[model samples]
Target: MNSTKIPALSENTNLRYANFIALYFAEGLHMGMLFVGIPAWLAMQGKTPTEIGAFAVACSLPWTFKFVAAPLMDRYAYLPMGRKRPWVIGAQLGLTASFVALAFVPEPLQNLDILNIAAFVASFCGALQDAATDGMAVDVLEDHQQARANGFMGGARMIGSSLALAIGSWILNVHGFTAAILAISAMIGLMTFVPILLREQPEEKILPWTAGNASIQNQTLQVTNWSIILKSLYSLFRLRDSMLVAALMFVSMGSYNYFETLLPLFAVKITGWTNTLYSQAFATADLIGGIAGLLIGGYLIERFGKKRMIGIYFFLIMVITSTLILSKTLWENSTFLYGFIITYRWLNAFAKIGVYAIAMQCCSKKVSASQFTFYMTLGSLGSMAGATLIGPMKENFSWDLTFFLFVVLLAFAWLIMYVINIQKLTTQITNFEEVEPADKMNSLLPNF
Candidate 1:
C-alpha cells in the first residue's frame, strides 16, 4: 500500500478512537471464550488429562504459525473496508459461527470423535481471528499509541479471560455444560456487532505477493507455503544476540504455557474440585495477579529499567515455581492446596508481566510486529514441549515429580536469562543510533 495514503489520525481522531475501542472489546471477548472458557469447559466434562492438553495445543497452534499468514494481511488491503478490517471482521464472524456450532455439539468429553473435530474447528477459527486482529491492531495504530494500545489490549484480555473462566465455570456448575457452551457462543456472536460498527480508512495501493519484492515482504507470506518465509527465518537468526533473545523467549513463554495448560487438570487430580470452584479459584488468582503485575511492571520498568526488572522477575518466578511444586509434594490437605494454587497463580502473574514487557521492549522498530509474532510462535514451542514432556513424565513419574520437573525448567530459564545478562543487553541496544525516535518513545512506556 502507498503508506502515505493511510488515513491520518488528525482527520478522524474521534472515529478512530471509537473503532479501536470496539475492536479491542470484540477481540478480547472472542479470545476469552475461545482460549480460557472453552478449554476449561471441556475439562469440566470429564475429558482425559491428555485430551485437555491436546486441546490447549490445538488452540495455540495457530499462534505458532501466525508468522505465515501475517504477510498476506500486511500486503493485501481490502479495497472498500480497509487493509486489515476485512480480515478482522471475517475472522470474527467465523469464530462466532464456530462457537455457535460448538454449542450444538454433543458432550465432547463423552465422545472422542465429536470432541476432536469440534475442537479442531474451533481452534482453526480462533487462530485466524487472533492473527487478523493482531495485524489490524498493528496496521491501524500509530507508533506513539502502541503502549496505550498494548495496555488496553492486555487489560481487555485479562478481563475477558477472568470472566470467561469464572462465569463459564459458574454456569456449568449451576446448570450444565451445554448451557455454558451456548452462553459463550452467544457472547461470541454478540461481539460481532463491534466490528460492524467500526469504520476503516482506505489505502492508496496494495502490495502483491511476488518474487521481485522479496526484501520487503516479511509480514504477508505464510511460512508453510512461501519460500520467502525461509529467508525471514534466517534474517531473524542473524540479529545481534538473537540466540540469547530466542532462548529467553522460549523459556519465558514455555514456562507460562506449561503451567497454564496443566493447571485445571492439576486442580482436578489433587483437589477434586468441581469446574465452577476451579474456575473461580483460577479466575480470582489471575485477576488479582494480572492487575497487580501490570501496575508493578509499569512502575519497575519506569524506575528500575527493563533488564533489572527482568532479572528480578525471572528469579522470583524460579523461586515461586519451585515453591509451588514443592508445596504440592509437602502439603496434601484441601486448605493447603487452595492456598498453594492461589499463591502460585499470583506469583506467576507477576512474573509473566515482567517477562512479556521486557521481551516486547527488546524488539527493534523495523521488525516489531514480525519479531513479536515470531517470539510468540517460538514460545509456543514451550507449550508443545510441555505437553510432550507432561505426557511422558506423568506416565513414568509421580505428579509430585512432574511438578518438580516444572521447577527445574524454570531454573533452567533463570540460568539462561542470567547468562544473557538481558538487562545489560537492553542498555546496549537502546544506545544504538539507528533506533527510531518513535520506537525510543515507545520504549519508555509500560509494555506488559
Candidate 2:
C-alpha cells in the first residue's frame, strides 16, 4: 500500500519520455539546419568548398567543448523548477533568439566571417540546450530505461532534422534564407512550452514566480562541491572499461558525421542535383532511418546487448558502404544514390543508441552530468575532426580511396570497442557504492 508512489517526477514514464522527445526534435531541427541545410545552401550559392567546410567547423566546434558547460547545470539549477529544467528552458529560449539573430546576419551565405559568428553563437546555445537535456534524462530515467530513451530521443532528433532539411530547403529555394530560418526558429520556440508546462517532480514550479516548491527528493540529490565532482570523475574514469569506452567514443561513430557532411557536397555540387532535391532525398532517408532507430534498434539492443548490437550494425555499415566503390558506373543514377544514403542512415543506429546507452552506463550518480557529457563530447570531438578533414581529403584523394580510408577508421574503432567488457562495468558501480561512506553519499547527487 505504501509503495505505489512513482519515484521519478511523480509522473508516468511515457509522458516524461514524450516531453524529452519533443525537445530533442527541436534540437535536431537546428542541428540538421546547421550541419546539412546551411552547407547545402552554400554549395547551391557557389561558395568554395573551403569556406563551406570552415563554416561546418565553426558550427560543430561548440559541441566538443560543451563539457565545460555541463558541470554548471549539474552543480546548480533553479531547483524549484527542477535541477536541469532551468538550464533547458534558458538554453531553449536562447536557441530561438540565436536563430533570429542568425537570420539577420546582414550578408549572404558567402560572407564567411559574419556567417560563422552567427553560426557559432547558435551552436553554442544548442550545445547548452543539449547539456541540460541530457542531464534531465540522467536525472529522471531508470538504468533500464536509458537505452530505449536514447533510441527514442535519437529518432526524434533525426525526424526533426528530416523536416528541417526538407521543409527548410524548400523554403530556402523558393523564398530565400530569412524566411526559412524564421520558420525554423518559430518551430523551436513553440516546442519550448513542453518543458515549461511539465514539472520535473510534483509540486515543482513551472515558472520562476509560480506557487510551486522544490521537491525534497531533488534536494537530497544536489551536488554540493566542485572538488567532489572532480574526485568522483577521476575515480570513475580510471577504470579500464571507462578508459576504453572513452577511446571508443573518440573514434567510433564519427564516420557518420564525415559521410553525412560530405553528402551535401556530393549530391549538390558533383551530381548536379538541385539543393532542394538533395535535401528531400536526405530527409526521406532520415525518416526511414529515424523510424528504424526508434523501433528496431531498441528491440535488438534488448536482445543482443549494446556491444554485440553495435558490432553487428558496424559490420553491416562496412559492407553497405563498400558497394559505393563497386558501383562506380551507377554513381549518377539517382535511385542508386538515394538508396545508398537511405541504407547508410539506417545503419547509423549504432551512433543513435548503442554508444549512448554504454556512456550513460558509465556515468556515476555523483557526477552523472559531467561524466556523461564528457564522454559525449569525446565523440563530438571525433566528429568535428572528421568533418574538418573532408575538404582536404576530397581534394587529395580519389573518391574510392577516400571511402576506403573512412571504412578503415571505422574498422579500427570497432576493434577497440570489441575489447570492452560490459560485465566489469557493473562491478565498478558497485565498488563505488562501497567506497563512499553512507553519510558522504548523502551529501552528493544520486541517480533519481
Candidate 3:
C-alpha cells in the first residue's frame, strides 16, 4: 500500500502515542496468556508445579537472551517504511502464526515436549517484536515524550495482560483451548495493522511494494557493518556515567526480581495462605499498581526529573522492604500482607518506566536497539543472580537477612542515581560519533 495521504507517525502526536501504547498492549497480551492464563489452566488439568514451571522456563529463555539477536535489528531491517517497523510487523505475523500453531498442538497434555517447543517458537517471535518495537520507539520519539509514552505503554501492557488472563481463561473453560489461542492470536494480529498503516517518515513507503524510498532519517540511522556497531558500543562502554546507569539498571531490577521470587514462599509456606488467594490478590494489586503508574509515573518524572523520581521510588521500596524485615510479628496479618504487596508493586512499576526513560536517553540512534538491549540484558543477569541466590538464602540465612540484602542493593542503586550526570551523558549521546577507524579507539565516549 502507498502512503495514506497523512502525516508520518513521528510527526503526528496523538497517533504516535496511540501506536506505542497499542503495540505494548500487544506485548502484554501474549505474556498474560503464557504466564498467567496457561499456568492456571495447567494447574486445573492436574499438571505438577514442576511441569508448569518447565513451560515457563521455555517461554522465558528467549526473552532473557534476546539481546544476542538485538544487533540484527540495528544492523538490518526494511528501511523503506521505517528501519524497525518491518521487523515489528514480521515478528508480529510470526507471533500470530505461532499462537495458531499452539492452538492446534495435538494432545497437549500428553505432549508437553511438543507444546514446549511451540511455546519456545512463539516466545522467540515475541522477543523479536519487543526488540523491534523498542528500537522504533527510541528512533522516532522525542526526549520529552519518552517518559509519558513509556508510562502509558507500560499501563497498556499491564492492562492487556490482565484482560488476556481474565478473558482467555473464560474462553478456555467455556469454549476450549483452541478458542483461547485464537483469541490471543486475534488480539496481536489486529495491532500489527497499526505499524503497517503508518509511515515513520511522511514520504517513505507504507509497503515495500508501493512506490517510495527510505527517508533520510532512516539512512542516517542505519549501521553499515558489524564492525561499526561493535566499535560504537566499545566506545560507549568507556563512559563513566554509562557504566553507572547500567549498574543502576541491574541492581534496581535485580532487587525487584528478588522480591518476586521470595514472595510466594513467604505468603504460602510461611504465612499459611493458599496459593489461589496469593495469586488472585497479588494479580489484583498488580493491576491497580499498573494503572497508578500509567497515570502518575510520567507526571512525576516530568516534574521532579528521572533521577529524583527513581530516588523517591527506590527509597519507598527500601522503606517497605525494611518494614517487612523489621516487622516479623506481622507476617500473618492479612492487612499487612496485602498492603505490602500493593505498595511494593506500585513502586516497582513506577521505577521501571523511569528507568526506561533513562535508558532511552542513554541510547544513540546508531545502535539503539543493541545498546538498550544490553542494559536490559544486564537486568536479566541481575534476575538470574537474584533467583540463583534464593535457595541458598533460604538454606543458610534468615528471611530477614535475605530481605535485608536486597534492600541494601536498592540503597546502592539509589545512591548511584545521585552520582550520574544525565546532562553530560546527553551531551555524549548527542555528540556521539561512529569510530572512523580502529586506530583512534581510546579503550571512550567521543568515538562512539
RMSD to native, candidate 1: 8.1
**Candidate 3 or 1, higher lDDT:** 3
Between prediction 2 and prediction 3, the one with superior lDDT is 3
Order of the predicted models by TM-score, top scorer first: 3, 2, 1
lDDT of each structure?
0.59, 0.80, 0.84
Model 1 lDDT tens row, 238-350: 54555677777787677666766676777777767666676677777767655654445345544565556656766765676667666755444656667766777756655
Where is model 2 more than 4 Å wrong at Cα? 1-10, 46-54, 106-115, 258-279, 326-333, 384-402, 430-448
Cα RMSD, each candidate: 8.1, 4.9, 2.2
Segments in model 1 whose C-alpha atoms lie over 4 Å from true places? 1-65, 79-83, 105-118, 136-151, 169-182, 189-233, 258-277, 293-304, 322-330, 358-370, 391-408, 415-448
The deviation in Å at residue 217 for candidate 3 is 1.6
> How many steric overlaps are in each model, in order?
8, 0, 1
Predicted candidate 2 versus true structure: per-residue lDDT over 302-408, tens digit per residue:
66788788888888888887888777887778888888888888888645588888788767655667888988888877887888879888999988877777788
**Candidate closest to the true structure, highest lDDT:** 3
Model 2: lDDT equals 0.80
Clash pairs, model 2 backbone: none
Q: Which of candidates 1 and 2 reaches a greater TM-score?
A: 2
